[model samples]
Target chain A: MNRSSQHPLRELAERTRHAGAVLRTRSLETRARVLYEALWALADKKAPSGRHAREALARTTGLSPEMIDWSLAALPIEQARLLMFAERAEDRVPVDLAGVVLAGNVFVAAIEPITAALLLGAPIVVKASSRDDAMPRLFRAAIREQDPELAEALAVVTFPGGDEDKERALFSRAESVVGYGSDHALSELATRLAPGARFFAHGHGVGVAFVVPPDHDADVTTITDALAIDVCAYDQRGCMSPHVVFVEPTEHVSARDFAIQLARAMDRLGQRVPRGPLPPKVASQQLQWRAIGEAQGGLFEGDGFAVALSSGFRLSPGYRNVVVVECTRDRFASAIDSVSRFVRVLAQNGQWVTAPADCRCCAMGEMQRPRFGETRDGIPLHVAFLKET
Target chain B: MSEEHKRRASALIARLAPPHAIPREDAWRARDAHLEALRAFQKAQIPVYGRLSERFGALPVDVLRHARATVHEASEDIRVFLTSGTTQGARGAHPFRDLSLYDQAAKAAAAYALFPDGSLDLCVLAPSEEERPESSLSYMLARFGEWFGERVTIAFREGKLDLAALSGALERAQATGRPLALLGTSFAFVHAEDAFAERGVTFALPDKSRVMQTGGFKGRSREFTPPEMRSLISSRYDVPASFVVSEYGMTELSSQMYELTLRHALNGDRAPIDATRRFFVPDWVRVTAVDPERLQPVAPGEVGILRIEDGANVDSVAALQTADFARVVDGELELLGRDPDAVPRGCSLAIDEVLSAGDGAT
Candidate 1:
């Protein structure tokens, strides 16, 4: 082929085309082995690249050391589950090429789609976010150590956003494009994809925790501790981080009282997983939100982390800024109705409650660490990204 | 506003606007008294504030936060001003039962900061009150127009800039040898400059010509540093950088801050306006930078959240806190940009490591 003046991305697409064909022919056993080995590589903390990945992710993302460790600890479990999920799946047909625009909110966030594409036998070309260019490389390194042939199918590239020519090159050739970012960014990227290209957009989302009154005497301290993790993990930057907790009133404690307990727990947790210095914008937003919450008759305590108790249904300005809105059973359901559109996960405590069909209801404190094969944003990852032949 | 409210506001204005510089202690005392009175008024009249005070310490910003969406008014003649809302679309609505207080504060602050030599030919680059009745900026410009009388010209209408009308007014002022004042948001000026550049138009106004721009880009447009904006204003209008003052105000507060540029320019001070340029508050307003988490005053020169005590805001809450990060320098407030909630921590280091790993070969 005469390739002078051809876009550089065309070569990248062409290189991945054969890998895509190879992926389709790969057995489920082969895929499971690759995934299991990759998981083992990630879990190997003694490995130099593994240690470097954790440190780099912690430093770049500004996630506390504990938060970084938590993410690293959770990844193996998630990947192992993905391994089992792939082993069970039979109708896996790989697309020619899949393009992924990963978000930098959390370092491990890049793994979700990358691993999903790998599991489904789709060759992926990832455009890593500038905020987190290290993560994709780390994943690629792990995969290469485990299965070199599988690693060839994945490509991670970094470029400044809004580069039209490069973006068109990627979109024109890719059978599917997955974008993770703010709603505006996702929409902007969606507009650039060629006709009939499969597009999956993950926009800004918030997670909320609903504390149902336990049948037994509630250990408020333990519950608060778990909720604190949900709030403090990734400094509440991830979409799965709990922004608000709606507590159902109990004989022992009122919803507002639970908020106060949650605040104390957050304060204690701050010492263990100290919140990193907030960026100027995040600090200002947290302050503004706190001020607004206070002015509106909400109680606010702005320590290293912030807690607000109000009747309002507004999402907390994430960065360990947690809002506790008091709600009865009826009001809790209604509040869910109002915020359901933006809620990605609803972490629940006490009794099992019916949430909006779209939101995933998990046990409290498990919001941030989603299990593999679980539907993210109510879309089953195993089947959602796969195309039927 | 009710006649009674107007009378109270007028009396407060008289106390605020002294012919000469009042003692700093006296100014602070008056401010504290006004704040206490306003707090008392809100607690009695606004149920939300009353509840919040009972729960949390009585901080005006705290009270304002609690009453963000609710209408908190002591009187029936209330006008609600809403914040532009965050990306999440949750706007904080502040109610003013007596806008006469707001009008008086705006007029007096403008007189001191913007037009110490008295109002000249005024050209506002924002929409009229009729066009955006809900906008506090539009309302303030309308008040300025009233203060400047018939010579006031508005160059923005129906959501568009009337560059022709602005150019005509500028030319008329130039021909008449009359000093002019151009007022608008920073983005509006950027738009005006771009428009003028497209047409190869520039102006050198009279010696005392001044420009007052407020409301930083707020991420709506590309942001220009203060020095950058001053340079653009200076070059485009042939006005000295010292004469291009920035107004710092928000809808939540009746009072405003202005850069000392106008005063410096009128005095023929050739000092170049740099990033260190500080905004001066009127005698009636006390501006302090407080730690965001503790809400305690930070040491001078340290960046902190801004909290204001404006005596002019007699009808509404007098104490307010804003998201703008600022620091006190030599008794004046130097604004930094809004505090970013989170800074990407060590991306440069990661990038370096990645490059060294030869992963950047792609």
Candidate 2:
């Protein structure tokens, strides 16, 4: 409720709006090139700016260096694929100015939205999360190297949320607003946006994995390995990170048995990749969740991960904690439906008889590395920033 | 009171009213015996505990896995008190079949840990039982007022602090030269302080004035660390820091613990009392800090999840575990904040409010 002086944000938004007009006249190819260059800049670790950006990201977001590097490596592929998909669409006109509210849960979350805005040729004004203010700055640095003109189109602002006046100034000037946060936060932000402004709300959502174990018993380990990677990605902080894995009962294996295997795989992956240090609060929640599951007689824990067989699905506090629930064909639909409101992506080993309509289904291990231009929460990110003309 | 309730209350009080000078080993043996008896009672009476005993071992932490379970039978005459659900929205219910026992435990604990000698004028910075019948804190304060045989001045009404009324009470107490006792959550004091400052009002109570600030800021407001709060209370009320006690309690338990500041002050220990250094647990309650993962007692001086073995919770399960982290020093608890990621629990419901206020994602 503490409002910072609104002059700075208002001034920045005005500048960004001016920049947006210049950006909208640019060709799609030029926008794509800018993204490609920024991606290359992010990977140029030898460069001082790149090194500084990486270090700042690591410190601010509490992500390990390896995880930051992995996220940076994936950015180029994701952006290129998005650009390719966007080119296929007709009747696409970039919004003059797009406002993006980025979440701080993952280190590289800003890159996707920023790149998507570029590909759409929309100058963007970003409100970076307090937890990771370095992300937008880093992206801006990368953009400057690619094209100083494109860099001028992006403005990153930082302030405590809930300053209605400052937020109103930003929303009123923008043609569209895209926000990523909890359902509550998205709704609250939506209420603040100006009438007639396009709003894209990516509310907090969870990912789950459905493993129909291979008909043969030998391939279980392979399935577990893929599932482990999905869980380890972003330390299960991203919405696409699996919190619960629904293992379908197979002739050779029970869901509990598969959970044990998955736990082992998680342990192996933890040793190889190693989780970043957990904030004390997160560590305590993880410990409490595991303890409660253990006391109930169904928890299997490894060094940096825990897999529990629970009757109901509960979202993990992240840090590689997962719940594995056994569901029969009859119960699978109802089980997934119960948590449908929060389900973003459902990664499965094979096909299911039926799946939720809204969630994007993918092959195991692909939750984190979705095929380029895949719809998130049923919305195509490729065209999200475009206004049909 | 029902005969059964009276019997249970007397038995619990007899076991928990011993002097603090009892040797550590002797105290432990007595506590273990009482805990064993309480566990047996819970297993026999509470079906959930019975199932937990069969499934997991009879450890208190294990039994508390079903903290949210409705364990009381339908036939029992019970008052169901719901937790504030500071962590998650699913509130834990603690049912009491015998109100008399709860009152007895509350009174005894307050006497030993807070008042000790005699009662003072009661001014509660919370709602009355009539306003919030389900609040254990309001109920406890009402009981305290009854014991003190004074008209309780409720400083908060309709979810707003009545600053004028609180200030008036302080003024009246000063005018009458009567010692006063202030009781409320930490946030209530902060709000009072802010209100007083805004109006340019300050008051120094009579010489024997004391305060019992319970409940931490559940992320609803800017958190005031214990020292900061002690300083604020001491400066505002003209009471020394040693006279400002912090009471540690929750809706789940019938008994409570108080920091020994008031006791030290009463004992004429002129040396500055670091209230944060130790808390006085009543004889009826045992506080243990256990490794969160293992649910086993952590080494003394190490921080861990706080587990309570409260003998006073006669109608419900006696042993409970909380998501709060604390350290045990010389058989006394050094209050630590709630586990950062631990689902918020308590009457504060601050987390739920903050989340609803837009801190949480879908």
Candidate 3:
């Protein structure tokens, strides 16, 4: 096929695939160095690209400057971890060219998928969400700044969702497409793909926390303080953000009391790493959730935060809102059964009941900060882009 | 129901019905007093309302889902009006001991806003009361058909609109050369329109014909703006844009609000139908936009969640907080659809999504 006559998407895909073949010939250490350089460039607050990303993400994401900084803190994956992932990924065969459909929910969500595909030695053409194209674009720019050759292996594109021509163009060029979005969108994308095309759908999921009150200590301040961080992080936009926390109430700490304390902690966090401004729709949803909370049991709220002491587990609308329900150990399993399928991350203080098989269990404060090499939605990060063994 | 509560219910019902009887001047005062009395009665008669009121200082309309907010005993002869459980499995139920108040309020509002120009045949594309006993919308449509419609044809069956039957009814009405009143949920109308479009058919009904569209897409059909809906209905049904009226009612409340376009057009108002499309609350109900978190009334024009006080809700909790965002301009409610359920911009599942997933739609 004549290069000049090729569709733009096909030309882009061909160029990226040629670069991926070149990338495959390079040593793992060289590729790791390229990624490491790009990561640090963004991590360095004083760097021009880093500064630009923070400000641009703040403007595009509606997140506060402080919140954007907090999200950036999760980046710059350790050099050692990258090397380990690359080493383990040696046997895996990557698609010739991979198509990535990035979600706009959380800007940081773009990092893992993009990195995973690169680690698997696959060139990628990413269609960034219109609502949030800043991070992916900035990340691509960062990579180009570090290594122009490696940057050729990545191309960031943007088009409105539901544009069939653009989607068909992508399908024509890529053997595999990885999507991060709501289930409805994922299903639609799946239907658009050709027969036998590989698709990895990272659909939306919820995170929940389980609080086991200290056996003797009356002060649950430490627990609430940490939980508040999880709630405020990314404005609770990430799948790992806790929407509800089921507290096992003891004499020392009651669920209602914990809700009040959590609300206070959220207020304090709101002052430091304040929540981003809520769009009118989110604010309205928060109000409706608050009313439902008020109806269910008790509601304790402050500016930009609410802690509803719900009688049953109710998912918060995110944006630093949370529902705290009281449950004894006996009723724990049955209570969580309702939301088990949607639960992605289960942050807990003590082991009471085993989490759902597919759910990731973590400590109270580390809900949003899954460790390096952690499998996302039960798939090894890099393996998501590789051929199934 | 207790004697004291019954007495208060009767008083509120009598005052609210025949909506014209409420004095135009200081109508808010009467409505406020009635709401105040109604709240007091709810506090005394409804246990859930009393508990929620004591704890939270006010009862939200959502309480209707958790517990019945009615004065009548559970065993008593009561009719329960249910909300479509779209969000969660929680379907809100408003129990009524006397359908008489509902009947009177329904007829009075429809008479003034929907049928002010006189009766027309009703072509309803929704389930009847016998088919969907718990649906407030079905009950209201059924009542409207009986009270004002000279001929009624209900074409909804088994969760689907019988478009063929609806088309036949339209043809019959057109043949009669008598005016018609078509009533259906927005989704139902969209279904009919799509079905008609596929068959390359459209209706040119008789003069004075109108369409009453209520409810939202609920993810059932494609969504359209108010102007778009009016245009679609107008073009497809051969009615003027002003004849496309939108009704806004919820199961938790007794009173329904309607767009003033039809009533205004009948009254010789020359304004464009789009400009006059704001929903008008009856004199028997007070609609206030209140701060969602604080639950306090916001400034007149600022948007807030609507908190309605319906005197017609004499048997149930009267002060109902709806999850709809609206603003008041010139005493008319400019409804901005239901407060949208939180959509995860990120990859996190929203509450509504999770609930719907559990229902197997995922």
Candidate number achieving the greatest DockQ relative to the actual structure: 3
Which candidate number would show the highest lDDT if scored against the true structure? 3
Question: Mind giving the per-residue lDDT tens digits that candidate 3 earns over B70-176?
Answer: 77787875788777877655777888777877777777778878998777788899988899999989999888877888888988988889877798789997898
Q: Write the per-residue lDDT of candidate 1 for residues A1-389, one digit (tens) a residue.
A: 33322877767877876687776677756776676667656656777766877777766777777767666766764445666777544656667788888777777777777787887788888888876688888888888887777888888888866776777776567788877776656777888777788787776667888886554445777788889988888788776777778887878788767777888888888887787667666665666666556654455464678787767566655778887877776777667565466677888775545676667788878888787767777666655346655
Q: What is the TM-score of each predicted model, taking all chains together? A: 0.80, 0.74, 0.90
Scored by lDDT, model 3 comes in at: 0.79
Which one wins by DockQ: 1 or 3? 3
Error in Å for residue B122 of model 2: 6.2
State which candidate, 2 or 3, has the greater TM-score.
3
Candidate 1 docks at the CAPRI level of incorrect
- Model 2 scores a C-alpha lDDT of 0.73
Candidate 1's DockQ is 0.21
Please identify model 3 stretches exceeding 4 Å from their true place.
A1-7, A218-221, A249-254, A257-261, A328-333, A387-389, B1-59, B71-77, B163-165, B291-302, B339-344, B358-362
CAPRI accuracy category, model 2: incorrect
